[model samples]
Every structure is written in structure tokens, then in C-alpha cells.
Target: MQPYAQNWTHVTEFVMVGFAGVHEARLLFFTVFLTMYLFTLVENLAIILVVALNHRLHRPMYFFLTHLSCLEIWYTSVTVPKMLAGFIGVDGGKNISYTGCLSQLFIFTFLGATECFLLAAMAYDRYVAICMPLRYGALVSWGTCIRLAAACWLVGLLTPVLPIYLMSQLTFCGPNVIDHFFCDVSPLLALSCSDVTLKETTDFLVSLMVLLVSSTVISVSYGNIVWTLLHIRSAAERRKAFSTCAAHLTVVSLFYGTLFFMYVRTKVASSINFNKVVSVFYSIVTPMLNPLIYSLRNKEVKGALGRAFSLRSWKGQ
Candidate 1:
């Protein structure tokens, strides 16, 4: 072993310092997160089921919505259960093996990247629908939608491989304490004893590319959508057109807002506590809110949900 390597022992595991010094409210925190997790699962599953069973929703828009719901389910799952374990003090709720940490980081990064691209695709779908109604059917046909969705997944799957492999190769010698709830990229990067300039630069460049491209698409799509909506002569027709895009806009704002603050910033490790708070919004809160945002704002989704449950109710009776 090298002299520096010999000086310090390799870290086998890491302790996640999640909400440390909060022993007094562990139960309360556990209850809140548990409820949110379960609710997120139920809501996203309902969306998938409602969209699948209802033939009326067999369109490109609903197809993308179902993909989003499924992504949210897996996205939230990658981090929240481990967080809940910390709150409940399971094995002190903080210890994770090195392999486990990297696995979490890889999965989380992949899903997040996927959501960014998927949201952009959804925005483009809306733009085509509102801005070019005449050609929307041909432009966003099922084949096109399938291809777009597959590309999003493929890019997401590939984006994290380099960053995560770099992270796994990093030397975590002693002080294996992660200051965040889960093994996120920043926190893990902060804990590494190895020189992480290359890793940080690689991660930053990858993130910037994903965020810039995705956000640009979303912005341009919405810009045209807004322009088209403004040109409609009737106020009612304008409102109707705008409503279709509202839920998606809300979700995109919530998701991308936190992401921009967290990743595309000058100082990632400046404030650990604040980072945790912001992370909560995107990783935990946004998934829970997606179902509510879409279902509440969307008449079609609401109607489908009602019909789904009511049909079951009638069958039971």
C-alpha cells in the first residue's frame, strides 16, 4: 500500500447523520415521512391504474402522464425508505455499507435525470398539442411517444454511469459520516478523502448538460404554448387551453426549481442543512404533490378516477 493509503484505514461503511440531534421528535418525523411515502405510492399507483383502465385516456398526453407517475414512484422510493429508517432508529437508521451508498446514489441520479428529460418531452407534447393542433396527432403519435419515452429512459440510464463509477472509486478513509439523510452525490463527494476535482467537474458538466437542455426545451415549449393561448379570441377558449398546461407547469417548476438550486449552483457543500431542506422538496415533497397537482387540476384525470372507484363500488354492491 502507498504511504498515504497506509496512514488511514479504508472506510467500509458510512453513517448518515440524518436530522441529528432530533431525538425528541423522532416519532413525529417518522410518522410524517411514513405517511408521505405511503400517500405518494397510493396516489401514483391510482394514476397508473386510472390511466390504464380508462380507454378514454388512451392518448399521447395520458401516456406521458402514466410514465411520469411511474417514474415518481421509483424516484421517491430510491431515497425515502432509508430516510424513514433513520427516523425510526432502525440500526440507528443511519448506517449504510459503502456498496449500498453508491447503489443509492446511482439509482437516485438515474431517476432524477430521467424525470428531467421526461418532463421536457411532456412539455413538447403540450406545445405540439396547443401550438400546432392541426399536426399534433401526426407529430405526437403513439410511435413517436414511445420513442421519446424510451430515449428519455435510455439517456437517464447512461448519464449516471460515469459519475457514479468515479464516486465508487473514491477513497473514503476514516470519518465515514455522511451529513445528509441519504447517500446523495454532494454529501458523498464531501466525505471523500481522495482528490475529487475530476469527479466534481465530471458530475457538474453532466448535470449542467442535462439541466440546460431539459430546461431549454421546457421553456421554449411553454413559450409557444403561452403565445398560442394568448391568440385565442374567446376568453373561455383561452382559459381552457391554458388549463391543460397548468398542472405540468406547476410540477416542472417545483421539480426544476429545487434541482437548479441544489445542483446548478456555485457552492454545493456550503450549507448542509439547507441542502437537506431543499432536497426534501424535490425528492420527497414533489412526488407526493405530483398526483395531487395533476389529478386536482385535470378534469379528465378526476373524471377517470371517479369512474374507476365508482365502478368498483358498484361492483362491490
Candidate 2:
């Protein structure tokens, strides 16, 4: 072991000091997070439900969206409930077992990575639909969609394997407090007694590969989309095409904006408080807004939702 690794206490537990200096407003924080969590759950669930039950929504775009909704639910669930606990001082809100911490890290990282690929795939789907309107159906068949979705999940599941292994091998010393709400990579790494230079580099490379590649693909797709839109002579056609992609673009911006701020830049360059705030946006706020963004911007989703509710009402009657 290195000199730094030798100093570790081999601590088996950690205290998550989430939202420090906010004890006075813990109740308010708890109430707010609780409400958001519920809304996120209901909204995401409704998306999945509407997509699954409606035959009209069985196309490639909605198929990916149904899976994306599933990912969002689990992705946000991995952190918010525990953060809520911290707010209300339940289950020793500050304390977390070592195993629990690792589990949280793995799940959060896995789902997050998966969402990156899924988002890129979604952008590609839109690209096909808008740019190659005639070939969209044959190009984005059910088999192809399933394969892409599986690849996203597979790659996401595999990408974190090394990172998680690196995290597990690290030694934790005297200070076991994770300065964030969740067991995120940086906060947990900050507690390690091991020399994390290699670990940090590995994480950066992994994040860059996943995020940069996906961002590039989405950007290119949208770039082409913009170029294609310009050539359309009809004002109504251009508006419809742009509107179709606006919701996805909004989602991509929100996800990547906070993500790049946290990871793409120098690690630990920002204050822990700033990182936490950004984390809340990407991890909590973004997931909640995805369903709303898609539903509000999408005519098909709205129509499906309307039909679903109408059918439910008729059944109840």
C-alpha cells in the first residue's frame, strides 16, 4: 500500500452531510423534495403507462421513450429518497453503510450512463424521421430499436464496472463524511485514503467517452436537422419539424448543461455546494421534467394521454 493508503481508518460506514447549513429549513426542503419525488414518479409512470397501453404510440420514438421513462424513474429514485430522508432526519439521515454507498454509486452511475446513450439514440431516431422521412419506418424498425436500446443498457452496465471496482478498492480514513446528498463519484472519492489520481483519471476518461460521444452524435443529428429544415419551403412544415425536436433539444440541454459543469470541467474546480445544486438539477429536476417536456411538446403523446384518460373514464362509468 502507498503512504496515503496506509493512513486510512478502513472505515466501514459514511455520513452523508447533505445540504449542510440548511438545518433551519430542513422541513421545507423535505416537503419540497417529497412533492417533487411524488410528481416525478407519477409523471414518469404515466408516460410509461400511456406508451405501453396505446397502440398508436408503438412507433420507434415512443418505444425508446417508454424505456427512457423507466430509466428516469430508477435513475432519480437512486438518490432522491435518501436525500429526502436526510432532510427529515430519518434513519440517521447523515449515516450510510459502506455497502449501501457503493450500491447507490453503481446504480446511479449505471442508469445515468444508460440515459446518455438512450438520449443519443433518441436524437438519431428524430433525425431519421425528419431528415429521411420516407425511410424512417424501414430504417428504425422494431428490431433495430430493440438492438439499440439493448446496446445502450449493455454499454452503460459495462462502462461502470471498472470505476466501481476502483472505488471499492479504495481505503476510507478518519473522515467518512460524503459532502453530497448522494454517493456520487467525486464526493465519495474525496473521502478515500488511497491516492485517487489514477481513479480520477479513469473516471474522467469514462465520463468523457460516454458523454462526449453522445453529445457529438446528438449535436450532429440536430445540426443536420437544422440544415434540412432550412431547405423546406413551406412555413408550416418547417414549424412542425422544429417543434418535433424542440422538446428533445430542451431535454438534452438540461441534462448535458449540468453534467458538463460537473464532470467535463476540472473535477473539484467548483464548490461542493455548487456541485450539489447542479446535481439536483440533472438528477432530480431533469427527470421530472422529461415526461412533461415530451408530453407538452408532443401532439402524439397528448393525444394518447387524452385517449387513455377518456377510456379510463368510460370504464369507470
Candidate 3:
């Protein structure tokens, strides 16, 4: 099977069937989705601001936390605005030029990869702090964090570039109507009229890479965390350690839980919608939840918030 062989040529534009499935519900969907985006933006930005301005919060972990917020802002931008527009009849279906489609694919994959790796990094941070109290500082130093961050961003950007490029080169001469809301990889691949052997192979390999790399990192980090937790002599210390790890664990579970479901069960067609919900979980819901979980559940984040509010109250009074 030829990878780039164009079968049904002349398909240039794609009809994206976002939330317009029910015409009556379109307005409601738009309102709610728009609100979600607004809140996600505000929530994520607040996290960045709170972490940045709070001198007490100026630590390696919080530094990464801010970056994750920034990441969510960009990640959502890749899909939501256009989706909302389609709901309001401003743009029924975007005639995404070939270049635009690939660019979308690249950014989507890049952000997805970055988040996966960042979650792993956070997990490792928790692991080191819990499992190796004495050596945590040395192992996950500020310098090391920066390097890991750079590596994650670089991998996030570069790893998907080739595949997206490869996928774009393949001809899409058939039905261009994408069933899903966004211009994702799998759904896009289904639209291609060309034989997708190479593309599927590449996708499978990439899926394996995403799963193996991120999961392995989290597993190793948590393994160390567990081993260290087992050595705790007092119940209070154990609780303290558990609390510190809880937020990160929640994020890891949320991310990996959805991720594994999507990629792991790629064989079934019904799994696609399931994957969409999972993607929604990570893309839409997780950003809001991250700040809530980290701040509301975390002592340090709560303390930071308290200090922030106190300062504001004093200024107003």
C-alpha cells in the first residue's frame, strides 16, 4: 500500500461537526463552552500570577506549575475558539488549508506531549520529595528542573513535527468531513484517501512512545515514592508525605487514566468518542481542576492564597 497515493482528489475543505448536532442546543452549547473557556483562562492565569508574585511560593515546583498553566492556555486555544464560532454560525466549517491542518496537528501533539511529560516531571518531583528526603534537593535541583523542562518542551515540539509533516504529505482526496470537533490525528487520518499503512505504523509507534515514555517515568517516580512512604515510622509523617503527593497523584491519574484509555484501546471505533471525552477531561476540565486541586488541597498553595487575599484586603481597607 502506497502511503501518499491520492485516491479521491479535490477535497480541500472539511466540515467540522462541533456542537451543532442539535440546532436548538447550539446556543446553549456555545454559552456554556464559551464560559468554560473564560473560566479556564482566568483560573490558569490566576495560578500563574499567584505563583509568580508570591515570594514564598518561589520554588522549583511552583515554577513548573506556572509553566503548566501557560501550557493549558495555549492547548485550549488550539481548538475551542474555532469550535465556539462554528456554534454561532460565524464559521460553519473552516476550510483549513493544507498548511493550517498540519500546523494544527503539530501544535495539538506538541502541547499534548508537553503536558504528558510535565505530569511525569511533577510526579518525579513528588517521588523524590517523599522517597528521598535527604537527596531530593540534589537530584531534582533547580538546574536539573530547568533542563528537564527544556527537554520536555523540545521533545514536545520536535517529536510531532515529523509525523504531522508526514501525515500532511499524504493526499486527502476523499470525504473531508471530520466527525470530531478538532482536527486531531486519528480522525484526520481516517479522512485520507491514500493507503495509511505508513501513517498507521508511524501513529502506532508514536502512541507507543507517548505511552511508554510518560508512563515509565511516572511509574519509576511513584515506585520510589511508594518505597519511601513504606519506611515512614509515624502515622503523622506518613500523612504529611501522602498529602504532599496527593495533588500530583491526582493529576497523574487523571492524565494517564484518560491517555491510556484513548491510545490503549485504539482498535475499537466506539473508543473514539470515549477518547474524545477523555481528551475533554484533560483539555477542558483538567486546567480548572489543577489549580483547585493544587491550591485548595495543598497547604502551601492555600497559605499563598491567604497571604494574597490578606494583602488585597489591607490595601482596600
The residue ranges of model 2 lying beyond 4 angstroms of the native Cα positions read 1-8, 310-312, 315-317
Candidate whose TM-score is highest? 1
Candidate 2 residue pairs that clash: 9-173
Q: Is candidate 1 or candidate 3 better by TM-score?
A: 1
What are the per-model C-alpha RMSD values against the true structure? 1.8, 1.8, 2.5
- For residues 1-317, what per-residue lDDT tens digits would candidate 3 score against the true structure? 55655444666677776544457988887888788888889878878888988888887788788888899899988888877888788855445666676777789889988888888888888877777679978998999999989988988887787788688778777687777677877788788877677877777678679778988998898888777878888989888988887887887788777767665433435656665677677777776678778887789988877776786755975
Q: On residues 271-299, what C-alpha lDDT tens digit does candidate 2 reach at each position?
A: 88988889999999999999999999999
CA-lDDT, candidates in order: 0.91, 0.89, 0.78
TM-score per candidate, in order? Answer: 0.96, 0.95, 0.91
Candidate 1 per-residue lDDT, tens place, 1-317, comes to 34667678899999999888677998998899889989999999999999998899999999999999999999989889888998887875689999998899989999999999999999999999999999998999999999999999999999999998888788988789898999988888777888888898898889999999999999999999888877899999999999999999999999999998888753466778988999998999999999999999999999889877896766976
Candidate scoring better on lDDT of 1 and 2: 1
Candidate 1's displacement at residue 4, Å, is: 2.8
Give the 10-residue window scoring lowest on summed lDDT in candidate 2.
1-10
Q: What does candidate 2 score on TM?
A: 0.95
What lDDT is reached at residue 184 by model 3? Answer: 77
